[model samples]
Target: MNALVWYVIMKWMPKGSSCVDFVTQRSLYEVRKRPSKSYSWVAFMLANICAELPWNTLMSVFIFFGWYYPIGLYHNAEPTGAVTERGALLFLLIWSFVMFTSTFTHMIIASVDVAENGGNIATLQFSLTILFCGVLVSPSKLPGFWIFMYRVSPFTYLVDAMLSVSLANALAFCSSVEVSVFDPPSGQTCGQYLSACTSIAGGSLSDVNATSQCEFCAIMDTNAFLSQVNSYYDHRWRNFGLMWAYVAFNVCAALFPYWFGRVPKSAKKN
Candidate 1:
């Protein structure tokens, strides 16, 4: 669903249609380009990586503006009330589902196949990833097992959680997001913009009275976000259950196949 939507938009993109779009198109020339079960992975990774660049950037931009992307979309309009941003909630849910589905499917099947087939695992992974770069590429894959991702949400979640772990790992490098004194605002602070937090949305907040920097503010916001996400575990057992399930499944997914398939075979050969 997400792949189809993304590719459709890309088709109309002023730049050009992406390989994902081309691959998904109902045509022989395009399908011939796929040539393997791994074709789906090629499409998946491309869409996944591309999806992040925009979504993450947008979320960060929203924060840079005054309207903190609400962790939850609850709203209050009349006489102290609360309502959810239905659209935002829907978007997040769908996006999460789509991105997770593609990435998890590709990484698992391709990694397994490469290791089993005596292929350069690194090259196999890289090539599949690059195929996501709108390039024609593929990974080694078993027929039925590899395509199993075509419609498996549970397996998708495991793959999705592992991918999320990988992403959080990469982003973990930036222990903090600092807006230093020298870091100029991405906009001007003249007249209407003066003392206001200028953002892409034309929203701004007056600088904290006599505040030296907004980096601290940024940090607080981030801490708040982490706290909020962590708080979800406390707010509902279902959330806690989901996180544990995701984590457990990811561990088992990565470990079971590799540990059982790799070590035992080598040990037996010994």
Candidate 2:
């Protein structure tokens, strides 16, 4: 994708020209080259999407069957049985987001490279991208300024969408039993009233009394777990739409540098 952007910029723009001059010339040239430019742009976008689709699909399948299904990660209190569909959709959305964002970023970086006379900043960009994308820290934990970056980062949406699809309806079951007290003053015992004990939501230990001895039932429902981690599931599909919108924005943004920052071969001699 980066190479493609570089090629497009080099081929279309005049050399040894300032970004402002390149924009002016490109606009004039567009009148005659509009059709070709349009075709190339569409072709590039389609190629990017196509190239990534199959691999992403295969990985999604592997994760669903290998990790989610076998481990019962999608099991819920209601057992809706739509785990496969939801999980597949989630993965597809994530890939779509990744592909578009990558292309957009590459185009921007390519523009920068051209503007800077080909000084490499790929490493810097990669590190910044990762840092801002909520990979190193959860968005909820970030400070105010960084939180803005977290919200804008596509990874945030991806994580939310995945969590929603995978664990939205999941119910955490008690995997073991240990003798414990529910209420000491009431003389209630967990072992004596096993059926009365209910599965607790994740991060809800505050509701339990301090004297309660049921320390073993700390399991959480899927939704509750997500809440505890400050990840939401209510807008999973909405986020998918947002991701597509971001892709469109990237496509549009790529045009600016292509037109304004590109240098033409003729300008190199001057």
Please give, for residues 51-78, the per-residue lDDT of candidate 2 as tens digits. 6447645654654455545655545423
Off by over 4 Å in 2: 1-78, 112-123, 126-129, 132-135, 174-183, 189-213, 263-270
Model 1: per-residue Cα lDDT over 1-270, one tens digit each: 224333422332211122223223423322553355445533543443456446644543443232212422222111123123323333343334333333333334322433233223423443333233221211123245544432222322322322222122111112334333333345543323333443432222324332334332232222233332222112232322443454345434544454454322424563
In candidate 1, clashing pairs total 3
TM-score of each: 0.24, 0.59
Candidate 2: clashing pairs of residues: 13-263, 13-264, 14-263, 14-264, 15-263, 15-264, 15-265
Q: Local error of candidate 1 at 62, Å?
A: 8.5
- Top TM-score prediction, candidate number: 2
Error of model 1, residue 14, in angstroms: 25
Indicate the worst ten consecutive residues by lDDT in candidate 2.
1-10
